[model samples]
Target: MSTLEIRDLHVSVETNDGPKPILRGVDLTVNSGETHAIMGPNGSGKSTLAYSIAGHPKYEVTSGSVTLDGEDVLAMSVDERARAGLFLAMQYPVEVPGVTVSNFLRTAKTAIDGKAPALRQWVGDVKTAMEDLRMDPEFAERNVNEGFSGGEKKRHEILQMELLKPKFAVLDETDSGLDVDALRVVSEGVNRVKGNSDIGVLLITHYTRILRYIHPDHVHVFIDGRVAEQGGPELAERLEESGYDRYLTARA
Candidate 1:
C-alpha cells in the first residue's frame, strides 16, 4: 500500500520581520485508503503543513523529512511531486482566466499519465464526473474558477481530485464557504473518489460539521505549531463540544 510519512517537519515563511516559523516538529503518516483529519484553530499551521507537503516555494522546510514510500519528497520539484501522486486542493483555488476547465483537466491527466486519454472515453468520463458533482455541463467550457462562486471553486477542486486519481490528497479547508447543501454535495464527491480508488486523504478543517459527512478515520488536534492530540473520530466530537479552549489555555 502507498504511504506518506512526515517526521519532525519544521517550516517557516518569510515575513517583513524576517522568518516566521509555522510548523514545528510535526509528524504524521497516511496510508492509501485512510482519511486523516487535521482540526485546528486559525493560524495553527494546518495550511502550512499542507502547502509544505505539496512543495510550495513560499514555505521553506527548515528541518525534518517528508517521504512517499521511502522516496524523498522534499527533493522533488512541484510538478514532480504531482506526477509522483501527491495532490493538494488549495484553500483558495486561483482563477485561470484563459484556461477552460476541460483543457486544464485534460492537460493534467495527460501530464500525470505521460500520455493523453483516448478522446471518446475521456470526454465521457468528464461528463459523468460533472454530473455526479452537480456541476452544469457548460462549466467545462468556462475558464477555471473565473467568475465562479466560492462553492463552485470548492466543487471544482474536488472535480480535479476525482479525475486525477492521486495516490494521496491534501484538502485544505474544503468545507469553508459551503452551505449545508453544498457541503453535503462536496462531501459526497470526495467520498465517491475515495471509495473508487486507493486514495489516502489528509483533510484540514476548523469545524466538526464536515466530519459528519466525511467521517475521518483519524483525527489530529493541532495547537500552536504542533499536533496537540491525536485520536479517532470521537476526538472531533470532543472539540465540537468544548472547543479549542483547553488547548488554547495550555498553549497560553
Candidate 2:
C-alpha cells in the first residue's frame, strides 16, 4: 500500500514583517485507504499544513521533510506534486474565467497521467461524476467556478477527486458554507470516491458534522501549529461535545 509520511514539518509564510512560522513540527503518516481527520480552531495552521503538503508557493517548508512512498514531496513543484498523486481541494476554490469545467478536468487528467484520455470515455466519466454529485449537465459547459455558488465550488472539488482518483487528498474545510442538503451530497461524493479506491484522505474541518458522514480512521487535534492529541474516531465525538475550548485554554 502507498504511504504519505510527514516528519517534524515546520512551515512559514511571508508577512509584512518577515517570515512568520505556521506549522510547528507536525508528524503524521497516512496509508492508502485510511482517513485522518484534522480538527482545530481557526488560525491553528491546519490549512497551512494542507497547502504546505501540496507545495503552495506561499507556504515555505522551513525544515523537515514530506515524503510520498519514500520519494521527497517537499522537493517537487506544485504540479509535480499533483502528478505524484497529491490533490488539494481548497477551502475557497478560485474562479477560472476562461476554463470550462469539462476542459479543465480533462486537461488536468491528461497532465497527471501523461496521456490524453479518449474523448468519448472522458466525456462519459465527467458526466457520470457530475451526476453523482447531483450537478446539472449544463455545469460542464460553465467556466470553472465563475459565478458558481460556494456549494457548487465544493462539489466541483469532490468531482475532481472522484474523476482523477488521486493517491491522497487533502480536503481543506470542504464542508464549510454547505447547507445540510449540499453537505450531504458533497459528503456522498467523497464517500463514493473512497469506497471505490484505496485513496488516503486528510480531512481538515472545525465541526464534527462532516465527520458524522465520513468517519475517519484516525483523528488529530491541532493546537498552536502542533498536534496536541491523537486518537481514533472516538476523539472526534469527544471534540464535538467539548469543542476546542479545553485545547485552546491549555495552549493559552
Candidate 3:
C-alpha cells in the first residue's frame, strides 16, 4: 500500500534576521485508502506543511524527513515528486494566460508518464474527465484557469487529479470560496477518485462543511505548527460546536 510518513519535520523561512520557523517538529502518517484532515487556524503552518512536502523552494525544510512509499521525498525536485506519485492541489491555483487546458494536461501527462499518450486516447481521456466534473467540453480549449470562476478552478483541479491518478494527494482548502452546489460537486469528484483507488488524501481545511461530504478517517488539530489533538470524525463535530478557541487556549 502507498504511504506518506513525515517525521519531526521542521520548516522555516529565511529572513534577514535569521531562519524563522513555521512548522515545529510536526509529524503525521497517511496510509493508502485513508483520508486524513488537518485542521488549524490561520498561520498555523498548515499550508506551509503542504508546500514543504511538495518541495516548494520557498519553504525550507530546516530539519526532518518526508518519505513516500518508503522513498525520500525531500530529496526529489517538485517535478520529480509529482512523477513519483505525489500531488498537491494548491489553495490558490495560478492562472496561465497562454496555456490551454488541453495543452497543459498533455504536457503534465507526458512528464508524469515519461511518454506522450496517443492523440486520440489523450483527447478521449480529457473529454471523459471534463464530463465527469460537469465542465463544459470547450473549457479545455480555454487558457488554464484564466477568467474561470472559483468553483470552476476547483473543479479543474479535480479534473487534473482524475487524469493524473496520483497515489497520494494533498488538497489544501479545496472547499474555500466554493458555494454549496460547487462544494458538493467537488466533494463528489473527490469521492469518485477515492473509490477503490486507495489514494491517500490529506485534506487541509479551516471549516468543517466539506467533511460532511468527504468523511475523513482521521482529524488532526494543528496549533503552533504542531498537532495538538487528534481523533476521529467526532473531533470535527466538536470543533464545529465549540470552535478552535478552546484548543488554541489549551495549547497556549
Error of 3 at 56 (Å): 0.7
TM-score of 3: 0.97
Q: Which ten residues in a row have the lowest lDDT in candidate 1?
A: 243-252
Off by over 4 Å in 2: none
lDDT of 1 at 27: 94
- Candidate number with greatest lDDT: 1
Cα lDDT tens digits, model 3, 1-252, are 988999999999888998889999988999999999999899998999999989988889989999998899999989999999999998999999999998999999899999999999888888887888899988999999999999999999999998888999999999999999999999999999999498999999999999999999999999989999999999999999998999777876
Ranking, TM-score, top scorer first = 1, 2, 3
Estimate the Cα RMSD of every predicted model relative to the unseen true structure: 0.5, 0.7, 1.1
lDDT string, candidate 2, 58-107, tens digits: 99898999999999998899899999999999999999999999889999
- Deviation from native of the Cα of residue 251 in model 3, angstroms: 3.1
lDDT of 1 by residue, 1-252 (tens): 999999999999999999999999999999999999999999999999999999999999999999999999999999999999999999999999999999999999999999999999999999999999999999999999999999999999999999999999999999999999999999999999999999999999999999999999999998878999999999999999999999999877
The residue pairs found clashing in candidate 1 are none
Give the Cα error of residue 32 in candidate 1, in Å: 0.7
**Candidates ranked by lDDT:** 1, 2, 3
**What TM-score should be assigned to candidate 2?**
0.99
How well does candidate 1 score on lDDT at residue 143?
A: 99
What does the lDDT come to for candidate 1?
0.96
Model 3 stretches astray by more than 4 angstroms? 15-17
CA lDDT scores, all candidates in order? 0.96, 0.95, 0.93
